[model samples]
Target: MRKIIHVDMDAFFAQVEMRDNPHLQGKAIVVGGNPEERGVVATCSYEARKYGIHSAMPCRTAKQLCPYVQFVRPRFEVYKSVSTQIGEIFKRYTDKVEFLSLDEAFLDVTENKKNMASATYIAREIKSAIWNELYLTGSAGVSYNKFLAKVASDYEKPNGLTVITPDKTQALLDHLPIGKFFLVGKVTAEELKKIGVHYGRDLRNLELSYLVSVFKKRGYLLYDFARGIDEREVECSRVRKSIGAETTFNEDLPLNSEAARQVLKALAEEVSMRVKGRGVWGKNLTLKVKFSDFSQITRSMMTSYPIVEAKDILIYVEQLLNKVDNLDEKVRLLGITLSHLLTDEERLQENISLFEYMESLR
Candidate 1:
């Protein structure tokens, strides 16, 4: 059996805000946008959740539910920075890290850099390092596969660490509600209930052919999940297609001016730093602009030579920025992305097919 660990940041966006501002500690904080502007909650603290606040809920409703709740605009740049720090910590233990999102990932530590046999120990150490160095809490779940590891991590909330050993995997799956299964949304759960598949054991009872006829691809996945079997590997061989940095301003910038150019220059510098750090260069440069109205546009230019320096990036980015025809529109977000990348070292590698392996499980 392989060893996999899923690490999820606790209330990522809101938690980052709270960490930076001590006064927000223990207070109900919701990070997204203003309630007056038809904003919605991106994510809220546990305290805010008590008031029936949740991600994707409208900010106006959140305020109505709890009058004193604080709503703040998201600072994505800060969140990205924190995510990078956490990623560095993960790389210390294993190179087989698959980022599910900015806040969560699956790490295959079957053969880890630390030479530690216990995946559970690595999970604990990672959690400790994040807390000590970044002052942020993360939950980890260890199992033989990605599905179980993800479920185990979410079994408990903030700062949770759960391990589902091979022996105990079946028992846990049988008792776990169908709704609790990863990727089972509300509609799917309701449909499952109609078929008397309310739990993992219920799901296990369904015929695979019948499942395939009804749910197609997802059916095969659910059947395997019911049996505590997931053949998917932690895909660490993925390559970065592009590297970019963006900034959303508190105030919108007027079009065709030094303010926009200055912002682009700063973003180019940051993107260049990241590109150089990765020992990679790009042949295409793109400038992304989001207007105050939220509609966005991207202008890109391909160069004969790879861009590795900030000065070269800035030149192309500035040229692309000038190509924007809607100068009358107020720009609220500015970004620069370098694409058509060439890395110093190959990030891609081959893994055995999961389908054949999965057939053995059935």
Candidate 2:
């Protein structure tokens, strides 16, 4: 059996803010932009969650939920720096680290640097290291495969560790809610309820063909997950396929030439910053526009050279925007995407200063 551990930071952004400023501890705090502005909550503290506040919630709604809640703008650079520190800590045990995001990862420590035979012990040590180095707590879940490891990690939140041994897997999964299982989304959960499938055991009772008929391609994967059988490996060397940023608006923006330009410019800047932060450059720029009718369209351009800077991205963004046919329609969303990426190793060697330039923005 393969030993995998999933590590998830507790309320990452909010926790980091509280760690830096101790006065914010034990208070209902939110990390995002001004509530009065077109801001949304990136993450909120457990105290804030009591008021029904959560990530991706509108800041205004969060404020109404808890009038005393404190809101702070996100510090992406600081968060990225902390993420780098966390990555380094994971590397100390095993090179088999797969980052799900800045705050979560799966580590395959079957053969670790310390030769630790017990996965549970390695998990405890890793959690200890994170706390010692960053003064932040992380939860770890150790199991025989990725699915159970991920499920175990999230079973408890804000600094909890759970282990699902081979013997315990089936019983634990049997009672677990269908929605709690990975990839069984809200829509899928509701669909399962119609057939009296509300838990893992209920799902397992269905014939494989019935599941396949209902969920199509995803049905095969769900069948394996329900039985606690996941053959997927812990891919250590994961590559980002694309980098993009998008905004959902409180009000639709008219497709007037100047109005569209302004939205595209802002989106391009955000995308450029993220691309630079990841040390990647792309040859294709895609402009995605969602109209008031909920219809969406994307226009892309393949450039001769890899693009990274906001100004360069804006140039292509303008070209693509001009290609969009419906100028009179109102837009509800605007996004910029960079594709056909080349990492720092592939292109930065030619221009060392370019990498330095990207870092300087942070």
Candidate 3:
């Protein structure tokens, strides 16, 4: 059996803020942009969570939830520096580290450098090292596969470590809430609940054929997950699938209005900058718009040649915006994404000039 360990820092961005400013400890703090500007919460401290605040919640809503909650602008550079420190600790025992984000990673130690027999012991040592070296606490989960390891890590919060041995996997999963399953989001959980599938056991009881018929490809994953099966490897070098940027407006903008067009232009520029920084290009441009009622829609355009410039992206953005069926609705958020990415090397091989590509499209 493969030995995988998943480590996730506790309320990472918030914790970093609290750690740097000792006076902020034990206080309700949120790390994000200005509430007055309709910014969203990146993360909040445990003290703030009591007021039903959560990540991605609008800062305005968070303020209403906790009137006295402190807000701190995020310091991403410092967090990335700290994340690098944590990564060094992981390298001591295993080189098979797969970082999911700045605050969480998966380590495959089936054959570790330490030659340690117990993955549990390695997990403990790594967690201890993080606390000792960086003054940060992380929760770790150890299991035979990535899915269970990730679930076990999240079973407890803050400073926690949980292990899911092969023998204990079944009992724990059978009682696990369907909402807690890895890939089951709020919508999927609600849909499953409507069918009386509230827990893993309920999901396991459903026939595979029935699940596939209803949930399609996702059904296959659900069926396997309910039985504690995840065959995915801990990929050490994860590829960037897309580059995107988005903004939520303080006040809703009329759909397809000049104001909305300006926002799309800004988002396209941001996406373009990021794509160029990463030295990559893409052929697929997607425009995402969220309405005032929280209804969302996305329109995409695929081109024969790669897109790299903001002007090029804006052309498709306007076209996609025009394609929206709900032009009468007001938009609360606007986002632009470029996918079907190709690296600098790959783009060179394509041998297509941006000018020629634009001409072809016209």
TM, every model:
0.67, 0.77, 0.78
lDDT of 3 by residue, 85-128 (tens): 98999999989998876788999999999899999999999999
| Candidate 3 C-alpha error for residue 66, in Å | 0.7
lDDT of 2 at 198: 93
Ranking by lDDT: 3, 2, 1
Say which candidate scores most in lDDT: 3
Model 3: residues with Cα > 4 Å off, grouped in runs: 240-285, 289-297, 301-326, 329-362
Residues 1-362, candidate 1: write the lDDT tens digits: 79999999999988999999999999999886567744556789999999899975667788999999988777766776788899999999998998765688899999999999999999999999999999999999999999999989998998999999889989999999999997698779999999898999999999999989989998899889999989998887554689887878899988677877766766665676456544457888888889999999989899756777767987887677678888877899998899887643331211133445667899
Tell me model 3's lDDT, rounded to 2 decimals: 0.86
The parts of candidate 2 lying over 4 Å away from their true place are 190-196, 213-216, 240-298, 301-322, 327-362
lDDT of 2 by residue, 1-362 (tens): 89999999998888999999999999999987567854567788999999899865667889999999999877767887898899999999999999766788999999999999999999999899899989998889999999999999998887999999999999999999999888897779999999899999998888899889988988898898999999889887665788887877798878775766765666665676556545568888888889999999999989767888778998897788789888888899888899987765676564676768788999
Per-residue error at 272 for model 2, in Å? 9.3
C-alpha RMSD for every candidate = 12.7, 5.4, 6.0
Superposed by TM-score, candidate 1 places the C-alpha of residue 18 at a distance from the truth, in angstroms, of: 0.4
* Cα error, candidate 1, residue 258 (Å): 37
* Global lDDT scores for all candidate models: 0.83, 0.85, 0.86
Which of 1 and 3 is ahead in TM-score? 3
Residue pairs in steric clash, candidate 2? none
Q: Which ten residues in a row have the lowest lDDT in candidate 2?
A: 270-279
